[model samples]
Target chain A: MEFFINRSYFLNKITNVSHAISPNSPNPSYSGILIFLHPDMIHLTAQDSTMAIVTEIHPGELNQLRIESTGHMIVDAKYLIEIIRHMGGKNIHVMTVGDNMIQVSDENSKFNLFTLELERFALPDIKRPENEIKISLKNIRTTVDQIAYATSEKDARTMLMGVNFRSDGKRIITAATDSYRMALNYIDGEFSQNFNVTVPVRALQEAARIFKNDDDIIQIFVNKRKIQFVSDRTLIQSTLYDGTFPDIAAVIPKNFKSMMELDASMIIPVIERGILFKDDGVAELRMNLSEKGIQIYSGASTIGNADQQVYEVFYQGEELRMAVNGEYLLQAIKALKTLGKVRIDFTGVITPFKVSDPENKDMTMLVVPMRSSY
Target chain B: MEFFINRSYFLNKITNVSHAISPNSPNPSYSGILIFLHPDMIHLTAQDSTMAIVTEIHPGELNQLRIESTGHMIVDAKYLIEIIRHMGGKNIHVMTVGDNMIQVSDENSKFNLFTLELERFALPDIKRPENEIKISLKNIRTTVDQIAYATSEKDARTMLMGVNFRSDGKRIITAATDSYRMALNYIDGEFSQNFNVTVPVRALQEAARIFKNDDDIIQIFVNKRKIQFVSDRTLIQSTLYDGTFPDIAAVIPKNFKSMMELDASMIIPVIERGILFKDDGVAELRMNLSEKGIQIYSGASTIGNADQQVYEVFYQGEELRMAVNGEYLLQAIKALKTLGKVRIDFTGVITPFKVSDPENKDMTMLVVPMRSSY
Candidate 1:
């Protein structure tokens, strides 16, 4: 392979692809980035055990590329990125030398890196049909943010570590749960077919990051064994798990004994202060609602006890009190901060409760209360 | 004990004193901050096994303190800081309620924290004499920055972990070394006594952080067992090490066979880039100096090799080459970056070399060469 390209432009491409390459992979070739030089563009591929990222860089007004010969090589991802990032030159010259080595040089520095054989690097085949669905980047990003945090980080159950995506020709519903709490987001769109799939939360997060600076919409194709996202110059593919997601509709509470409406900005600070003694989110906090006002309090016998009151709250029905995870409540409230006010419903002390944004009615968060001695 | 003070002003005092308290201390009382409420001011003290920091907050223009009674109590430093940091009120009210507990409340929140008995909290007695030397805060801060990085972190040689401060009734000299490299700084000041003491590098770092916004001059008192620093509203005391510091005069070379002068801005980037393949500073790089110019290069058999050259250099001697730690050379060069052009002297291939700032004659850094197989 032989090529001359802009130094900074090459660095940007390698950094994005390096995120998918795991440094601890058992196979040495999995840790290398596959580089293929063509007459018009250069293609790069990096992968881990279950995911692969491929991107192409073409000659444009801002990017300079000149290809002398067409060839391919696999270089170590970590070393290549480090060398390119620190080289102090505007243009870089790259050419394959003898004895399985490549020469990379700028104006003042030269690096000769050992490369692996092309036959050792293998990428799984992915099918990209022409009938793939096009979804707005904003909708996909919102779905990931609204549901990814609820996925389980504990590896006891592999099914809970993914977010379920379901479409019924008119609307798309995404839900995530780790048995204690569930987050659901509803996005309305047009589609030709109905489907349901569970994607790993990490894959969704990577897709969201890649779309942060892209165009308005992208194409998504889902199969029985894999899923792919196609943009202008990049394609991301990930393997899907074979399991059924839990039924979220049946678990959501239908009615509540009491409901309160208040601005999210008022109670956030109280909860933040009350959790200082919450023992790193392991301790439970009691939330009290009554004719007097709203109060949140937690205590540790050896450390301290904190009690805080919210000044204004609109209430109806009977007063109720329940113990909930302090950290989960804070996250649920902060997610609805964009809306002016939020509504919280209580069914019982041991039953699940719901928090909803008044303006964004398509989204709701359900949190299960913890049993408390108080 | 009872008092009402400004929340922000109270937080600043505890934050400064908390630096001396270690979270992993075996003694429970040592992890707590001592609070003594007086008629005129509130004094706070925190300490570990080797150092103690005591600071006072008075009723000044910016700070408002109202004391109802004079008493003392010790509370966990971590919990107190967290409560005060998140409270949403201008003035905080603190009072002892009952049963070894104190109630801290603002307008919206209240906290009851358990406290340790007054008799269990012990602070070592430090001596302060009438005859003491005064040093500028700027001088102390600069000295800490220049020498602290060279202190040894290994526990095998406890004496090398402290920086030696020596005085001759007119100037104070500070030096630190880890057996491989040494850094020395000389501060000229008016003094009335001569003394030498080795203080832990951690203590100096804490003192520098405390004086970041204090007055210009502070008094320093040294004795057989401890050293004390006194300002208008604070006093810092630290224990002295028993062993003597290493003699730096014997290691610094007096004559050199080769010398080179170059702008520090010209070579910093080259070294920074060359260290990319240096395996986190374990690998050594070769520096070639001659009438031709200056060049630095390093290589790993399995990875790659990097070679870079300096743009302009003024040399005086025969051609020579030596291997040295890349990280140490980079640090020594960066220390003199503010003085513009720097002069470097080499005695031989394996002998110690010196990097000095031409504008600042009182500071010098010496680094020893490593024996390489190249």
Candidate 2:
């Protein structure tokens, strides 16, 4: 097989598929990308048992192309991508040297690599599910960004590394928690079924990257053990997590005694300046709400103490004090950046506080407060 | 003692002296910046055993000041600088809280730190030498920038960690080498005496930073064991290196059979793009000069091979091939960034090659060629 492709164009196409290539996988075929050259098209495919990605190059993208025969070869993803990335000119000439070796070259550079036999490579089954849901890639990106960061990345409980997607026939709710804080979003759309599937956060992140435009339509196919996302002629299939997520109603705090409503812009900077000892291990800020205003205090072992008064806060009920991680609160606040005002509800010093953006009422952030020492 | 200074103004003044305050210094006193709150002014001082730096914030710079008593306190340099950097208001209040503690506060932030008493802090004895050389900081910076990077940073041969300074009552010759490559600069200027002193590369780099302007006149006082640089109301004293520098003439190649002159800008990019296998341990580029043009070749075990033609060279050399480290050549080219065209003189395959800019005749760089295996 022989074909010609633009260097940069080939690099972009290979980069997406190469993400699924785990270099140290026990299965040698999983460590490479399948380069399939057809008479009229060329594409690359890679898989890491649990997930698989495929990307194609259309007919008119390359400068020139000639295929001696339709064939496929598994080439090391890293070396192939690196060669094309650093190739001299725009056009690249790729050809099959032998049954187990391929040569890729340009005008002044050439690379030959031993490839795995085509029979040994396994591409994940990506047939459309019984009931596929049509969703905008943009909406998925927003929901993923809002909830994925709260997932437990290093937790040995593998299921916590994913975001729980629960649909009750009409509305779909997405949530993520690391046992410390929970971020939940109520997406305004209907899904196919009432399935509660825990999709890995990494898969959601990769899907977000694949779907560049917010309005682009993407087809999501779900099964008992796998989910496939198809968009713009590319397919990303990941395995479904095999554990159950905690009940959202039980995890979210409901009642609060004292509530403080403040301008979102005013509170962000106040927290940034007030929490001066951020470089130390865990960043904590104390919030004391009075009838007049709210007082924020933070101190570090060596870097002094800070006390800032924010008169913009509207307080109700008796005086209340709560201490929470400053960075987590900042992130939860930034997630609602488009909103004009933010409201924080505190029940007691030892209780979890709930934060909500007045403008975006569909989403709420629950922050677990640390035991106060102040 | 009490004083009020602008936050940004205080940050900049403290930044210079804080460099000498090595936080992990063996002596606790060296980790703090001594704040000498005089009746009319306040100055900050910091020192590691080998080096000391002092910077002044004069009386005119502050908005207001009321010095109740004249005393000194050694406050932690890092914490003090961090507090002033993130201070809320324009003016910061600095005062002595007690016998061994200091307080720095503003409208929204307050910092208190335990300090080393004035009696325990050991200040280096700084005095003007009998004879000192008056030189433009700009010229010294230029010379230091060109040669300092060539020295051995962690080599057991401590003298190689510094640049050699030699004078003949008229010209100061500076050179540095890491036993592989050598950088030499001959600066034409008058000096107080014909002395040879090896100044640590770190000291030269710090002095270059202290003297911001090239036209600023700096007095360099040299003694048997220490070198004192007084510039712009700041004094930086560093212990001079106590050993002999290798004879540069014996190290530089004296004979060559081939020479090539090329535009430095053209050569830099050609080398960068032609040798992309840089992530591997050692980068070797083979330069083959033919009657037509020069062809550069580079290859790695996994990352393929690269060959590019460079037609922008003026060559009268025979058919010769030499392998050299690409990064070393790139660094040498960068050192001559201001020059338009660069000339490289080569002797043989094993001999070192000398590179010089046609415009800047004062500096010369010699790069050792690696022995070829292919």
Candidate 3:
């Protein structure tokens, strides 16, 4: 392929796709980026069997593109990235010289890199799937941001490693849990058919990064084995984990006798303070309510302990003392945007506790309490 | 011990000494900070055998300190730092109760931490050495900053892991090298006696961190096994390496046939661009000089290559081609201030290259060329 592209534009496009290229790919071709120069645009594609990313750059601006020929080649992603980084300018000249060599040069420096035949690379099937879901980019991103962190990273239990996306015609629900703490986000959306699928947390994260325009709609094609997220000029395809996700909704408590309402930001600092004393592999949060205020305390045996500044809150039922993971509580509180208050629901010492923004009832975070000896 | 101190003051003092506390100390006492509350001031000390730092805070500031008693104890450094960080206020109340328990509390919360007995912790002896050398803090910091990066971190070659500080009654010289490259800095100072000692790089780094006031004089007490640096309210003691430092002055080239001058900042970017291609371990500097101007071309095989924008230079040689470690060149250039011009002296391909800022002749960096096949 013979083409001249803007150095910055080419660098930006290459970087977007290079994140999917693993250095230790089992397949040598996967370690390279597939570069295709068509009549109008240059397409860069990289994948590591799990997540694939493709970005197309138009060569219309600044007379950035001069295509004399159309061809395809897989060039070493790492080397090409470094070359473009050092080239340093708006415009760069790239062309195919020998049968298996790509030449990238600027005014002062030139590099001739060996390339693999395009036929050797495993290109994913790009045909649109039969079952497609259209959703607003902002809604999907917000849902993912709110719940993705709760997914388990360890694959010992393969199902917990993915976030469950459930839709039932009227509403779309996203739930993630690692058995200890679960996050559920409910958003308004319409689905013609009920669907339940588990997408790996990493795939969701990559999709979130590639989908930047909030106003644009993201088209998701889901099948039995693969899921594809498409935006304006970018497409990310990932293989779904073939495992049954646990019923996270069943674990969320539906009733509570004691409820306290306090500001999320104010409560977050208290939880963070409690985390300071967490050592010996355990983090505990102790909450006590009195006529003065709500007091939060956290302590670890081997490390030190912390007591947080109390905030005035309205409490009902008997005064309670519950212990839970400080980190989980902190993460949940940080996700809440409106600083007004969070309603904390407690159901005795052994039951899971629920925390939700009082202003928004659609989002809920549940954390299972630690077995404290006290 | 009971006292109330400003949170910001205490935090800053603790942070300065926290770097000396070893996270993986075999002795638990080493992981804790030694607190000594005297009549007039409170002192915090932490040591890990390799290096020890002591900082003091005085009472009577913003009604923050209210001393009730004077005592000493050792509290966990990590936990204390985190507690203070999360405590969130200008003032913090700290007190010791019973034998080995410390309490740090604020307006709405209290944290009671278990502290180690002061007798169990080892505090380095800070007695003034008979053959101590006093140097201007500003001079020492400048010298250390210039040469410390060259010191080897690996203890396999113990001597190379320390910077050699040599004194000759009138001038103090500091030299550090990792065999491949060496940095030497000389500062004019009056010393009562001639001395030569190899101080560990860690000690130099600690000294640089604690010695903030340039006009303040830092007294250096050097014994057979330890080197002590003392400022007004801080004392940093470090163990000296027990190996002979090589005579690095012999490696510096005495004369040169070719020289080129260019701005340090201008050349730094060029080296940064060249470093992107430095993964293959070789950096090539192809210099072409004529009446027109001077240009530098550096490239690495694994990273990309870069051609630097030409700069007007006073050159006194034919076209020169040499390959040196890009890191060495970058470090030397960064050491130069806004008086940005750097002078490069070349002897031959086999000899070491010397780089220095024309404005400051006291500092010089020498880098050995790597044999390149290209």
| Candidate that would win on DockQ | 1
Best by TM-score: 1
Q: At residue B94, give the lDDT of candidate 3.
A: 90
Mind giving the per-residue lDDT tens digits that candidate 2 earns over A215-280?
887788887788888887788888988888886645676778888888877788777766556535
lDDT of 1 by residue, A276-304 (tens): 77665575788788867888889876788
In the predicted model 1, the residue pairs found to clash are none
State the DockQ, from 0 to 1, for candidate 2. Answer: 0.37
What fnat does each of the candidate structures reach? 0.91, 0.27, 0.56
Q: Which candidate would rank higher by TM-score, 1 or 2? A: 1
The most accurate candidate by lDDT is 1
| lDDT (tens digit, per residue) of candidate 2 on B1-374 | 77777777778888888887666787777778898988777777888978889876666644444455677888878777876776667878888876766877776556666676566678777876665766788777976778887888778788888888888556888888887788998875557577788888767778898778888888888877888888878998888887878878556777778888888867776677555664357778988975577888877765455667777678876668888898888888888765488988888777888989988887889898887774
Candidate 3, B240-315: lDDT as tens digits: 8887787777668888868888777566656676666555465556655544566666654543445654645767
C-alpha DockQ of every model: 0.80, 0.37, 0.46
Work out how many backbone clashes candidate 3 has.
3
TM-scores of the models, in the given order? 0.95, 0.90, 0.91
Q: Model 1 misses residue A255 by how many Å?
A: 2.7
